[model samples]
Target: MSILVFVEQRDARVRSIVREVLGEASRLAAVLGGPVVGVCPAASDPGLATLGDAGAERVLLAAHEAFARYDAAGYTLAVVAAIEAVKPQVVLFGASAMGRDLAPRVAARLGVGLATDCTALAADGGRLTATRPVFAGKAIQKLAFPRVPALASLRPKVFAPAAASGRTATVEPLTVGFDPAAARAKVVRMAAAAGARVDLTEADVIVSGGRGLQDAGNFRLIEELAEALGAAVGASRAVVDAGWRPHSEQVGQTGKTVSPKLYVAVGISGAIQHLAGMSSSRCIVAINKDPEAPIFKVADYGVVGRFEEVVPALIEAVKQLNAQV
Candidate 1:
């Protein structure tokens, strides 16, 4: 048996989540005594080195000029072709925007069942079991795969990157025949978000604000706190829908799921959808005027107060600590 992992890259750089996914694949492969193969679709991506370091026995690069921009249909087709060629028993993806968009497409093309956004995966008795949160994270569901290639998209940060054992794998080119322009969805005009901070998925510490921010201007306080702690700034779905922040900054079931080491939720009553995205954080701090808010149930610490009063004091405390350091 062999495991094939799709290496997710951006800006010609391998995202940290890809390394984590590779580590996860390596562990799964070890348990099943399977070889691990990494796949990257790019014309010239230097991040291939990191994949080799992550314990991939072979890294396959699918070079095409059309891959410069992400096309969901084109990428899915390329992945399907790669899987056919490699004939891996299992496949994995980093449950990011691209993975979320591409995984189902590949599964459908291959006429297989795929477990989406899996928090944990294990193979036993020649079957793959995928564990994922369901019902707004109120329950975790473990399901078995009944397909030729067990397909799963792993949530970012759920698996830690294993140690590099000083082995570099051979890089190979994938032979895929497809037309990029023939894809259904064409990503047009992608504008970068302003003042990019640490990636939310990769951040160890995250300071997130909610509807309690009131307006977009109040987000400056959150940004200030994030900067002081060297953390990423995240928002609840309410704030993102209100246009106070970009969709990328939103953390909820309908948005990006994150599991930072420390999560600070301000002025946001924890909804089930919101908790589904961040309940996996190592430590949670909830600051809300209503002490009975559902967020407190999952939070490690709680502060009952208004954001207008609490945020300034928190900022000052962070600043004082920084100055002392």
Candidate 2:
């Protein structure tokens, strides 16, 4: 009858999305009158003591050698085992690459319904409802679970992380055994992006550029502005299609969705696909030469001018502001 959160970690460090999921879960658990529990799969202890401050009363560690890297079959078996042992009424996962891949597999194994990419979650009268954008972000849909052990994946950066409570969670080891041959795929190695900045989905601020930049070489302007603001760099589908940026940095209906605290669109005309990904940002700033640009419709602030002239001024302004702070 507890809320179970899947704790995601990289290099023994917990992902920020886990804290976001845990924060929302804690709110739901308060209404459901249940405790919050964390389920983690790792080769060794990932230093999860801080989860208690994030609302986890207890942590379940499913230790296994295969868990060092993500193995679909191995992870599915491990998560299923944890669910079986705890029998939580609700289960939550971060809507990250790994979570998106693993949630469906776990749901299928349990034959339960799952809601993905939910931006809002609420509990009323002990019933949980999830809200997600649908129809290419043109509409919103609310979903309710008809069965126990309701499962859902939450979008990153949409919910604020829980404030520290100065509490420590009790860690317990969960025993799991799976056949090595059951894993059809194995991660041979991982290559980190060199000099990578904040992940787009997890960033608080984002600066995005589009085809209006005229050429791929102009992306350095976007990067420089992003650096000045300590933000992640994003690109529209057109830019990505032109091979100016990697698909990983693309923001659109076919790309990764984001809900950062601040979004700056430089030379972007505001395609619906691009809007679908970042419309949830708390603040939006659009800079374009044409006042009729579609992006201005949703922007909290708009500047009409060529980015070459406008961006440099904005970057200097930001630098001045940072220096004062």
Candidate 3:
């Protein structure tokens, strides 16, 4: 009947994945000629009302004390309840950590098929289909859903956030009768590092460094350039393993997979493991002293030079470009 979008929030803030999912939902809704309904779990968050700007005609909010913090059981049940009510032909979620954890539970509860980490969606022949990378992004597979209420989780940044429509959304209260005793895992407290980082998975642009940086001190090169470019700082697994950077900043098979619009690799001799994580990035620029590095094979732009010599110049150049803007 409608396209149901799961709105994910954290620390009282709406996550970018939610907006990204909404943008895709808007596109899908256009194809299906259906209205977009957003389902949010929480008490009245002021931010939850903004989904209308992203294409929601109406929002169903389940505001309750049990939803103040995430309880896997409580949240899952709330979503299932919303799904049962909406009875939509398609559902959309961002392929975020929360979405990955929750989408499966909802799909199982509804006895529906789900496609995870989808990079693309198509309205083909009056039906929706999804495409995802397989074999660690080395291959692509298109999926067709044979049932109504088919679920799909989108990879962040694959679609631009929809422009705000400047219309106020009608918010309705959703009822979630959650029982705390059913939840085994509970969030007690949350702490952040002194400096909050732009998560690699969510960042639109990333500047990552590797072992060729020589030591932790040289990481300033990556940081400075990232600052100039308004990009997140990422690190190769080698740099993280060597204690040159935090594990949270690591990007590779063992770390976070990112598909940012722009990815800059500095001194990272690209290993297959690392490529698998970021190969889907829209634009990749690799800088290395060794031109023969495997990273050059996949990089859209390659620079053969010492990062120390090149990064400062690049940072200055970016500053100049920004000043012009």
Candidate 4:
């Protein structure tokens, strides 16, 4: 038995989340007693030998022309084929945009239970349990799998990537019978966002603003702070709804969930919906005029002041620190 990880790729390169999944799967495999395997669907080989350092004992490459772009039907077939071939004890997928789409498809196709957005996993007595946030992050739930080959999708950036061990995994080719007609939908083209910053989900550090900024034009303060800290810019739902920020930068229950190493909240009132997305960050720094703002409750550090004054001082401090380094 083995733990199988669905290795996602882009532009013929492996995604960072795959390494995190593989690392976590390796840890679980140690407790569950098995090897960790990677199942990758790509148009071409992504040179995955380095994954061995991240604890992939072996990688199954499911290469096909249909895999050039993420066709839901084709990817579902590839993952199903890999599962059938490997007969893994557990299957892990990153809870990213692609994984969120693909995981449920595979689960429905195989008629198995699926857990999405899992933040933690544990193995006991050769059994696996998954932990996830529920009720808009107000409660936590632990789930157990009654069936074998437990399926789960892990939240990105929640788990630490495995340290390199100078080991190499053996890559093997896996063939899947893909039918063109089965693909009901196809991605003809993708338009990238103009001047896109770091993906919020994958960013190590994030600086977010909310309605407390007073006006849309004031977002420049948030951007300057993010730039100074080399972090991604995020916005509260109120800001997005007000058109002060794009929906892509929104972080909350209705927006994107982020678990960055450091999360800076400026002028955000910390609505429950907003806290749902970012409460898991390793370090949270909140700056708000109201000392009683809900955001301060979860923040590791709280600064009570208006953003207009607090933000500029913080940005200057960051710049001076960067200069010193």
Candidate 5:
């Protein structure tokens, strides 16, 4: 059987996470010597054909009025239909909020085992083995499912996105008799956050701040540095709780878990809950005045100085690096 990957989207646009999942799915398919298929719930997206570059041999798009907006129930139904059509041995999803909600429902409907938030995956002898964090990132658990198709959700940014191979793929339309009323939930309207920044989960670089920034006004330093690095802006729970930043920007256990290529923590004391969220980041840089801050312990590099002094210098350095490039 082949491998399948769910294509994630937002506001009539394909999300970067889709590429990440496809990259991983392609590798898993190689291990099993199987083909990779891409599945998406869209309202006639021409971009579906481009999935081939990421390693999909065929792309399936489920188009319907109910798909115009995201309703978990309708989406689940469409995905189930696609899964039944493909009959894949392994199905992969990027562990975004939507994927986290959809994977279990899809698994239950199909009567198969589902693994969530897998950081590592491997296919051995046509069997699937998944490594995931347990006890709030304190322990690791390896899971295997041999009897049925393996449904797994991968952590965002843990796997690098595969480059386009310039191969063309065939696009197929999936017919689903979608009923709008059948969906228990329907999104009426979608509003963006106050200021749109890079998507944290998909960003390669993120600059996160905490209460150490002193006040909301001081966050300018963080923003400036983010702009220099073309990074997303994130916050610790304390910053969110204090109303200095929105919950969307918060990066901690209670907020959003992000594993970017580079994570920069400014004036944030690392709490266990916060570490649980960003500990898997490929490279972590901590900047705080206190040398004893908890964030320094896990940081791949630490700066012992105030963010005000450090941020300006860092921003300038990034500018020079960009100019040289």
Candidate 6:
């Protein structure tokens, strides 16, 4: 009943979401009377050792020339091979761009059920229970899977990383066969957006503006507040479509999903599509002149006022808070 966690690498380092997945996998594995194992592609990835420290009993390195760049087919093959070798009872992956595309393929190949964008996972009475939002974040549904090697792709930041275990794992290198060129889609190049402050999914704090901002330059106020709190600046689809912000900075069903510790929504009316993406955030703060804005329905705190007046005050408050800290 061992658990297998797919650890992701970004810029040769482990992505922050990997640690959260480790914590979740460890808890589930402990309950199932199995050890948690971490799997990652090997190619001078500095994240392997860190995965072990996060609580994996062993770190399985899948090193092959094909894995240097992410070939969904190649990675799928490698994960399938690793699962066959380890015989894990449950598999976990962060529901990121890679995981969303990769996990389903592996699950389909294995002929197993897979839960995507799961907010919570648990092993109860010898079955895996997956909890996720449904009906556009208006409700939550819990499902149980009976098949062995249950697969799940978890939402980032929903689970917190546990304290470091300091346990060194037996690193096993996996050997598999796959052709990168055979993949239908090949990653040729990656271009980082200039002056992007945060990776939306990984940000602990997010300050987002919406149609209420009225214009793009108004986003600078959101950025200033984010900077003061060491947070990330985000925008709703309306703002992005209006060219008030970059699409990469948009957080909604049509864009990137995020579950930050603290989420500040400015001028957003809380459309269902927008809520679907960030409803899982730990704390939600809404600032809109319209008290009737739908966002306040789910907001933990609400400041009903015009953004031009409210945002500056919030920024000043955050600056003072930082000074005190």
- On lDDT, the leading prediction is 4
Give each model a TM-score. 0.89, 0.96, 0.93, 0.96, 0.92, 0.92
Candidate 6 Cα errors over 4 Å, as ranges: 45-47, 181-184, 193-196
Per-residue lDDT of candidate 3, residues 13-80 (tens digit)? 77877888888888888888788888888755657667888888888888877687666787788888
Q: Write the per-residue lDDT of candidate 4 for residues 138-173, one digit (tens) a residue.
A: 689999999878999999888878888889999999
lDDT of 6 by residue, 1-325 (tens): 7999997775566777888898998888778878888888746556576566788888888887657667788889888988998899999999888899999999999999999989899878878999987664657889877677899999887887867988777788887787665678887767764235568887899999999988788888988999998999899999889877889898877787788999999999999889988888899999999999999999999999999999999899989988998
The clash numbers for all candidates, in the given order, read 0, 0, 2, 0, 0, 0
Candidate 6: how large is its RMSD? 2.1
RMSD of each: 2.6, 1.5, 2.0, 1.5, 2.1, 2.1
lDDT value, residue 238 of candidate 1? 94
lDDT of model 2 at position 117: 89
Tell me which residue pairs clash in candidate 2: none
**lDDT, each prediction:** 0.84, 0.89, 0.87, 0.91, 0.86, 0.85
Candidate 4 has what TM-score?
Answer: 0.96
Better of 1 and 2 by lDDT: 2
Model 1 scores a TM of: 0.89
- Give the winner by lDDT: 5 or 6: 5
After TM-score superposition, the amount by which residue 73's alpha carbon in candidate 6 deviates from its true location, in angstroms, is 1.5
Q: Tens digits of per-residue lDDT for model 5 on 196-243?
A: 667787788999999898989999989999998999999999989998
User: Mind giving the per-residue lDDT tens digits that candidate 1 earns over 218-311?
Assistant: 8898998888888999999999988889997888788767888999999889988899888999999998999899999999999999988888
Model 5 TM-score, 2 decimals: 0.92
